[model samples]
Target: MFFGSRKGSEHNSGQDKVISMDRFRDGSSLSPIRQAEAYWTALRQGEDVPKRSQIDPRGLENILSQTFILERIAPGIARFRLAGQKLNEMAGMEVRGMPLTAFFTPTARKQVSAALEHMFDAPAVVELSLQTEATRNRPSQEARMLLMPLRSDLGDVSRALGVFVSEGNSMKTSQRFNVTATELRPVTPLLKPKMSPASKSPNEVNAGFAETQAKFSDEPSVMDEARALVEASRQSMDEARKSLSEIGKPTEKTKPSRSSHLRLVVSRD
Candidate 1:
């Protein structure tokens, strides 16, 4: 008795269910940042942070151009210990020995400084979303940056491994970026503490299916006891046989006796 458009209803339902999944995909444009973070995480192993000396250029060959190493010279201040060609290109000069704040605009420098301080102090992972101001000749660009804390040879969290990736066309002049967002993630230890023997109970210390009240002793085994019993039985049997033989034979104190009256009886037909 009711008239309805089934096809139209189904089409509307399908349209409503449509969802954008691009955010879940690892896009090519942001591959460098992901690669750098993955490499750092792998190097950490079970430690809070990886050592600076443990970093190898070979491990990050594909993203080497976008990678850089930072050394914390002072609180909230770090300079490029080593920088890649990509960073150099963006700065329009060699970025080594230059402060990381040089890559950011004046307004964003304080935020970057605070983030850097937190990264070295808290020794946490830092990520920054960045953008460039558009001009009449240059278009605005978006970028992502990652900073992972590292320990120096002396075992101090003053070193960092970092990566910078920018999207869209590159500017001919030096391009400074503004910090749009910052993310700080605390690092966790990968290894768990072991339980000491003192912490375990006496029963738990023994590694068997059943518990026994018997104390440990230097006694012989069950096989040894069985062997001893067998030896004693054999000696008793030998003694009995010897006694029978001695009784049957004439002894020094007894005179020889005549043979018994029993005769051998054999029946042959």
Candidate 2:
């Protein structure tokens, strides 16, 4: 199922604005938009943004299929690495590997591209209110798109974590939306405190050590590499052992051929 896979909730009224800080703190609305926002907040914690490797689809199960992950392939260009079924249905195509601009109208593509760049360069979160042009065949739509920067595995701010929600009937044809309104919030990176030379706090040293370990441990690929190496070594040793074991194995003796003793004669007429 694509965009219309699930029946949207009644409260998804599509009229609600991005939740405010006060509303967020007071636990006001439980709309899909707010749910997406809260999940992104929890993932980041105190960091500038969460890393690509840190995201767990299971943790975002509620909105899992409504979310997307994009990677900046070049300046002013982003390709979708993962897209939800809703997005696919809206585009009327498989959206993964497609540029984000593909979903927007020609007139609004530049604006959409600029917003994407700002999300990466400012390392910020952006929320946009979107609407598709109405036609006899396709009805208008009201949608919300949230874009948040994410640290790539190589430590660059080139990945985007996004969630999209729309309140309306799904279109029969591909939909092209325009950004009606946008809100951007800049995020500050959390820096580690420096220790003075004279003080040389032991706690600071321990913290630094733990941080270094965490940097490497956060990527599961490292552990995968180690496991692969161990498995290869074990296989090699097993092969070597088999070769050694076969060296002195006894061999079966063959019976002498009776054909050697038999002679065949042919007489000519």
Q: Model 1, 1-269: lDDT tens per residue?
A: 22334455755444434455565553444588887888888898788999999999999887788899999998889999999888888888898999999999999999999999999888799999999898999888889899999999999999999998865346557889999999999888877668775565554445655564355566799999999999999999999999888887865687778887988999996
TM-score versus the correct structure, for each prediction: 0.62, 0.58
* Root mean square deviation (Cα) for candidate 2: 26.6
Q: Over 4 Å off in model 2, which ranges?
A: 1-29, 189-269
Count of backbone collisions within predicted model 1:
0
Alpha carbon deviation, residue 39, candidate 2 (Å): 1.8
TM value for model 2: 0.58
Best by lDDT: 1
Question: Deviation in angstroms for 179 in model 2?
Answer: 0.9
lDDT, model 2, position 267: 96
